[model samples]
Target: MGFLLLAGAITAEVAATTAMKYSDGFSKIGPSLLTLLGYVLSFALLAQTLKTVSIGTAYAIWAGVGTAAVATIGVTFLGEGLTVTKAAGIALIIVGVVVLNLGGAH
Candidate 1:
């Protein structure tokens, strides 16, 4: 259940970030509104997950996963460069998140 909420939060954040790329600095109406709505829902769902999940754990997963997903989208669909540095950075973020979760288990 908590994982479900966290997943929703991740999805909403990813959607919001993707829409932001098309928002033209918030000058575009549709994408701008979608961005606003997506963030609202993301935070709301994240807050719900915090009821059962520790803030450090939840936030680590949320931010880490969101960053990775956005970077992947940028490379795959947004014509952004996928250099070795970018790949290494994403890998580090995933490793850090996993370490945080593992540490929290104790």
Candidate 2:
């Protein structure tokens, strides 16, 4: 559940950041509203995860995974080009997150 909440938080935060790009200096209503809602939900989910997860581990994984996820989201849904280097970078991030979690358990 803690990991689930963390994933949700990361997803929401990515959505919020993407929406912010479309908000056009806050001139667009739909994107602006989405940005606000996404951020609010992201923080709420993150806070909930803190109830069970260690703060340092949670924060590190959250940041690492969230960054990769957001980059994927941008490339896939936002029509941003995906370069080979970027793909490798995302893979590395996933590996790092796994290693971090594994080390934390010991």
Candidate 3:
């Protein structure tokens, strides 16, 4: 259940971040509202996730996955360049998240 909530939180966070890119510095009404709503939903779901998942594990996963997903989106859809260094950084983030989860399991 907690993991499920965490997934929701992560999705919401990703959506919020993606929307933010289109928000035109909050001058665009629709995307700006979406950004606000998405972040609020993300935080609410994350708070619920903390009830069952350890804070360290949940936060690490949240931050790491959200970052990786956003970076990927930026490269794939936002016309952002994906240099070798960027790819390596994303790989490291994933690995770090996995390591945190494994360590937290014990």
Candidate 4:
């Protein structure tokens, strides 16, 4: 359940970040409201996960996964260019998160 909540938090954060691009600096009412709502829900869900999960582990996974997902979304759907360097950076983020979790376990 904790992991599930963490996943929800990551998802909400990614949604919020993606919607922010469409918010037009908060000048657009609809997407702006969506961005705000998504962030609120994301933090709320993350708080729930903290009840059972270690903050270090939960946050590493949340930020890392959210970042990777958002980067992918940007490249795939937002016409952002995907370069070899960007791919390597994403891979490094994933590996770093895994290493953090493994280190935290001991």
- Highest lDDT scorer: 3
The residue-by-residue lDDT of candidate 2 on 1-106, one tens digit each, is 9989998998898889889989999999999999999999999999999999988878878788878988988898889899999999999999988998888741
Superposed on all Cα atoms, model 3 deviates from the true structure by an RMSD in Å of 1.0
Q: For residues 1-106, what per-residue lDDT tens digits would candidate 1 score against the true structure? A: 8878998999999999999989999999999999999999999999999998888788889999999999999999999998999999999999998888778641
Determine which window of 10 residues in candidate 2 has minimal summed lDDT.
97-106
TM-score, prediction 1: 0.94
Residue-wise C-alpha lDDT for candidate 3, range 1-106, written one tens digit per residue: 9999999999999999999999999999999999999999999999999999988889989999999999999999999999999999999999998887777651
**TM per prediction:** 0.94, 0.85, 0.96, 0.93
Model 3 clash number: 0
- State in Å the error of residue 6, model 3: 0.6
Error of 2 at 64 (Å): 1.7
Give the number of the best model, judged by TM-score.
Answer: 3
Tens digit per residue, CA lDDT, model 4, 1-106:
9999999999999999999999999999999999999999999999999999988788889999999999999999999999999999999999998888778641
- Which residue pairs collide in model 2, if any? none
Model 4 pairs whose backbones collide: none
Off by over 4 Å in 4: 103-106
Q: For each candidate in the order shown, give its overall lDDT on alpha carbons.
A: 0.93, 0.89, 0.95, 0.93
**What TM-score quantifies how close candidate 2 is to the native fold?**
0.85
Tell me how far the alpha carbon of residue 96 in candidate 2 is from the true structure, in angstroms, after superposition: 0.9
**What does the lDDT come to for candidate 3?**
0.95
